[model samples]
Target chain A: MASRLRSTYVLPLLKQRMEMCTEAPYLKLKHAFKDRCVWEGTVEPSGLSERYVVRITYRLGYDPQVRVLNPPLVRRADRPIPHFNGDGTLCLYPVDSGEWTAADSIAYTIVPWISDWLFHYEVWMATGVWHGDEPKPT
Target chain B: MLHVVLLWPTISGMFLIMCAATIRTGMGEDAMASQPTTEVSLDLILRGICERLQISQTQHDLAEERYHAVGKWLDAEEVPRLLKTQVYAQGSFRIGTTVKPVQRNEYDLDLVCEFNLQKDTIENPVILLNLIEARLRQNALYADKLERKNRCIRIIYANEFHLDILPACPDPQTGPECVVVPDREAREWKASNPKGYAAWFLSRDTRPSVFGLARVEPLPDQETVDEKGILKRVVQLLKRWRDLRYCKDPDNAPISIVLTTLAAQHFVYQNSEAAALTAVLDGVLASIPPFGRLVVRNPMNGKEDLSERWDDAAVYSAFVSGVRNLHTQWHALVQRKGIPNITAALEALFGEQPTRVVAEEIGQRIQRARSSGVLGVQKQTGTLTVATAPAATITPVRPHTFHGK
Candidate 1:
């Protein structure tokens, strides 16, 4: 049972990061951009004992490429964004009295908004600061 | 002038009664008796009183007519009357500073049924489209038949202003985010729990950006017990969008040119260019106009990912320049709009205007940005001057004069 758990948890590190990405530059940029880059670093990895799971550091004016560091997909898809909390929610909904609809009519605006963030401002890039006019400290 | 206070009210009342009697004789007394004017309170009644006071030659002849037309709309029930009223024009869709013979008329307007949506309190874009479509078919003189698109919803009228009725939905959730478009699949998703969805999607779990200009709406106060937080988030979203639209893009556009420009404005005032660049870039995705194909592209593959948009270096440069130009254009355009006081405009939006003026201040900002240096470098960089964008060629704005004249 202990060996089985170790294989499940430890096999990925043992899989030797079988990808073409260099770790040196990755470590460098991770620190430089405040570790907020989402693509992680030019990874074209495959056939690791499992899918990798590295923290994603998003970038602006860039394409959305995930940093696959590990998997079982620790967190799966269609599932809420792993780190997202109802606390910092920021999506617009119908100005309706009741439940918000899933209609597609507003996609042209909202999708590009997401697409631009994804392609431009990768959502995963968390640098922990507000970029707008900050409330002036009294 | 003739000691007419009570006497003044008496004469005006007599004239109104005469007009009412004439209308009643022509139409019917019952119709005149049941209108909203009788129910209108004193505040709105002042409009007629004020119109009676205009004292101009144009007004001397048409004051009563203007009063009747305007008062009928203002005093009458809002929704039903707006339905019957035809949209004449949308005004000043674009603003630029370049001077040209036609610059005055370069803007565009879209005709809409004040609230075009079937039962929408706010404007419903689709119903306006249907009306325009019907009108074009009913009118004579046609070349290739006018085609109605569900998305763009335009009807060509008099071969001039294509009455472009753009549809916008107002959610109980108001803010720049959570906005519904023509195909967001909102009707279905909203049924589950709109407030919950809007409330959830914009929740604090999304996190903040590196700079201070952008952020996701924070968590609900039910958790923190502050309902005003939701409202504040909505307000922030609105200002962000409003600040963005303060100017239209000139040449090459940036990804979030509006947001970026506003972001630059946000940081420049604080004297931090680094924060300005990052904030402008965060939480911003490629944007698409309601009427056009998507142009924002992904940065990773350096190619088109999901949409029809293509990613190119020129497009990127345009995006960057476009954002920067927003500041330049806005400074110039608003100056022409007669808000010659940039300080006031800046104060209204950003609260405290920056002490150092950005070089683009065509309006009266006190200190303009020094055009010589990089953001952080106080020393002037000989090459770092604001690009000589095509000078705003302000062509004559074709005033949307009275229809048929």
Candidate 2:
């Protein structure tokens, strides 16, 4: 009976927009009531800069996955794309590093991280230096 | 150039003032320098464009060397006709607002070759011009490089720069410093005052004079951020925009003197180059006559109209339309928010190659700041900051590596 009641209870839809999302009018949140919520928006790291479409997906007790949706990420000649996974998702920070956690708001942490990632990504493209701090994978 | 060397101490002093201002405002110094823009600061990218536009120290030295050689050769005692001739740089080079030509690598340097002879002795203005041409032809080096223009002798230095030496004599009726230059097409003596004009410009300029550098120092490989004052930078930016608009059809382009005069006349010192440029643009637009011809009188000599060339209806129309287009594009640039958008807008205003080079430089600077853990982000907007001392509204980003799978 308790399991049946839990199944019947409908999750509440997010009534108010996230404050950060509101500040960046270009970004929007979707599937707010679902287990997995996705936020997608355009991020221009600098003034008079390239527009990048970044999508971040998050669920309870799981790490947020960030990817650049538009202007497909590609390697420059004789250079590998830095700070990225083989599947093309950005490895923004080490999941085990405790630098970011599920408790942190996606609006506050993940969104800005994506912007920073793109910023460094462009810098790497211009000069073949990965400026983002990262630990060597074991 | 010695101008850059003498200005170094002044530049350093100004930078110290900037640092103090940053501290008093309780902002991080590194952050202030790293990020391109703030509420009242010139964008780094814009500043970068000006830096790249300026001639390098080596180039300046080369131009100085070439001009000095010509001056010495003309002033030599061996030349009876050219004795005591004085050679000095005029135009944008003298004023320190030279912008490299868009179409070529060569910079056009205007020089005044003032003869000791009296202007009254010369019956025809063309005679004085011919006399200088004959004197230059004595040397095989100058003879080979020399190209005759109507009023001046141009000595081209191949890929580097070209010097346009205008022959003139002291005006007896006016001040000794003023002179009467030849008007080739008109076959008359045109009253002009280059030295007086430079003095007037310097007096109006807020920065210390770039003249009389007794002590010379080697310029640093890296250009300092606080090198140019608001007025000079604005002039360079205007000239660059003009070049972009008129490179293909240069005959109709407005003269540099006209643009320089307008900018200097209407300049109200603003903290940032961008702000000062906008204000100057507004002043220029307002100063244009609504119903009649635009008259730009030389400040030193009111009798001389700097915009005399604009008497041609086609030239006047082209200049007016070009200025209007510049004003429109500048407004649109101000409205833009991100780096990509701003770069594209600047490219449209300036040129594509220079704008891209600056954008790349700025990107590297931001990346270095990020590596040093000086990066921060505003909570509301995703705008990045290189501020080490972030305020309450900012969240300082942590250092983390991007370990690829």
Candidate 3:
């Protein structure tokens, strides 16, 4: 079994990586304690005019959570926003697919996923279709 | 400061691990990460809308097949006087600015059938018009399709386009390409030069040298989408705007010829279609003469007034108001910033269905790029771009389907 990455090892790496990203300068670590950390930032996806404020919460052992803090996501007349959890956090990737492991960096994975999610969300609003990748049925 | 000094060796060890992590990500096949932002321009969206507006290849082929058949039938020597008559296309059909009808499928095509007789050879203008109508009536198919108008013999082809055939005699005095056609209302032969006008428009529609070699005129109805010049696209967009605005009051609407002429005249070479359209709009608004003043003259025959119909005070005012509305809406469209706002503005100007269809198509293309693993995000903006070459600072997003409840 692969050993879980320590929070001490993960947190500093996350901060360093986020600092290196010149594009997402607004994203900053707001709170860090024990094995949990939270980040807040704003992103405007290319081609979309709306700016969305995003909040990310991550604990060492739990799945990372991302939520749109501003411009509350609205459901279409015919359907709800696709790939969203019951609690309203985005389902950025398949949990069982091993696409995202605990070893992955939140700055590199979760922060960018938020932008990709919002991009598709706008596309969904226009087309009423979820254009993002969906997992295959077993 | 004391802690930093004490942990320096251990911190350096972790730094090496972080470097290893970075290298691992760099070498990994699926470094799906952030992407640079793709620059979406107004030119891209407008071109996409025009792509949908252009007539399909199947429709073009059918229009051509039918056009040739009619030309052959008219020239089959069915009428003795029309032995040397030539049938040819005119208007948007020839100039490649034809816009598909918003609510209907039937395109209005203009054709001129020039008889061998000179202007002096025909005693009356009615005689030439009657001869052409009679010859078409001889054929059972054409007789059923024929719908007589004041100036032209109309032949309906059901759901397809109907041809308006104007019978004329060569006007050698004006020019070789000029012809004198019968006007039933005026009881006179009006000197017109459709052939020359088309040639003139083509010359004006010439591709700029920057776009490389001059475009060879395609066969009638076969104009490809990419080959359309910025001026032609400007004309098409204007025509579509006119059609949607005048859906209920088509009779009072300014004709396509006036719009085409204005666009071609004021057309400054522009690399961006949006800029070209803006320039044309500004030029047209500036050139709209006051009521009863006729400034828009045919480029080919200076005597003919293209704005003659605007002679009526009501017609002139209506056209000016309609153009003003178009000008206002177009400005509003350009001012819009976001995709939704821009799309809403486009729907307001071009109609909802076409705008939505094109926007969706553009969305699908971006989605396909994402699925291909080439999608990257700009570290600064958190926007998407194609990761043509993977850079250490900017990482490619890993491939994963969007899934969950």
Candidate 4:
């Protein structure tokens, strides 16, 4: 059902990737690629829905970007790292460098990216240092 | 005369042996002779440790804010206006002995939502529970967050904290003051008086302040610090030890109320926090029989037994053994006279984080004192001493005296 809504190019790659990942059951793609493609999922192991809502919106345009929805992620005093924008969208990578492109699968790329961000965020909260490989915004 | 002379040496020899034993145990002149050079006395350190164990002011404020929010949310036009509702906090938060949760980032607040309604009108326990649930659902904020449990409605705030709101109706048999809360699992109403229990605990805190120190002033807009005696501090310290020791399996670990009730029962007002703690630990350890069952009852209400949770013998034994180990370590701390020994003992009891914080704070104080020239070091022994001005450069000649008369 979710595959019917997604782009033909994106859906096959997602299906191939979902078979390998354990987190596929918790994730769902809704209203894919027409008006706005929405990814709804649960971030597990932490398992708290309020703290880490996995609802994300992807809009297809000249410059494609992903926006976080549901729970707004705010910077905490303890973390003090700039990983998110004033808008709820995560500044996952440098957009100017074309890190994410339309050819990439949203499920394979964006979903895993969000999970990695959350994992690093928790580590940052505890240790006050981000150990992730992503380049932080100056 | 000859017999008396022979016995005098023996008596003198016994006295010498007693004195030697006292010094060896570090309980006599040797213990008192070496005074601390640093401004950080044991009392100050103990106070610092207690401060570390206490729940932060932010946590207290957030809990209060949430509780008040719930009360406000309940008083809506959709809810029935026939009964007056009131909220009261119970358990450690009420008693002023709440320790930081060892494993979790959140605190657990136990609250009761008492409604001024006669039992005749709301006859069934299920009806009372359903009524409260219905009212909570009316507010959009609580609709998704509410969880109906065996005894209370748990509102989980995800990462922040959860409030266990136990609904109650005024008990007819116990007059207007007492209330009966539902035991949903049993499908019956159980009698509990949180206010009365709290009052009894407060009354039992009759120990005089050992340090005669002013209460630690709370920050602006923070909750007022409760009047703390040595008993309260000991209770708090023991609770912290329990938390750290049983963090992995906190459910099977001894509950706070049981520990509090037992310690309060055995507590004797002492002149120092250390003494009070040692005495209470000794009291609790002594009361637990090695072979038989342990029964700790609530002092306020005879009907309620606090030790009901200690059902598993192995868990109870582990608790008893853990407390005994702490007592031995505490004794080692008392006898030893150094920062390292004290810190190690504290680390063993509380864990690494709090002990490290306290050690750092003391180090800072010593550093400040040293930089100001208030602290001096003896060059020969490298021992710390209070700084003093040098004697006058010119020595004055004095007359010699001969012993006479």
Number of the top-ranking candidate, with lDDT as the measure: 3
Per lDDT, what order, best first?
A: 3, 2, 4, 1
Model 4 alpha-carbon drift over 4 Å, by segment: A1-138, B1-39, B75-78, B81-83, B118-124, B172-177, B206-227, B370-405
User: C-alpha displacement of B372 in model 2, angstroms?
Assistant: 1.3
Share of real interface contacts recovered by each model? 0.00, 0.41, 0.56, 0.00
The candidate that achieves the highest TM-score relative to the unseen native structure: 3
**If both were scored by TM-score, which would come out higher, candidate 1 or candidate 3?**
3
Candidate lDDT (C-alpha), each: 0.25, 0.68, 0.70, 0.57
Query: Across the candidates, what are chain A's individual TM-scores?
Result: 0.20, 0.79, 0.81, 0.65
TM-score of 3: 0.83
Best by DockQ: 3
Off by over 4 Å in 3: A1-20, A26-39, A59-62, A86-88, B1-38, B77-83, B184-186, B208-221, B290-294, B387-395
Q: What are the per-model numbers of colliding residue pairs?
A: 110, 17, 22, 0
Model 4 chain B is weakest, by summed lDDT over 10 consecutive residues, at: B1-10
- Give TM-scores for every candidate, taking all chains together and pairing residue i with residue i: 0.22, 0.74, 0.83, 0.58
Cα distance off (Å), candidate 3, residue B118: 2.4
Position B236, candidate 3: lDDT: 86
Residue-by-residue lDDT tens digits, candidate 2, B256-374 = 98999888888886555676677888888887788777899778777668899988989999999988888878877777654455667788888887777766665555555566655
DockQ for each numbered candidate: 0.01, 0.23, 0.43, 0.01
Docking model 4 quality class = incorrect
Cα error, candidate 2, residue B211 (Å)? 24
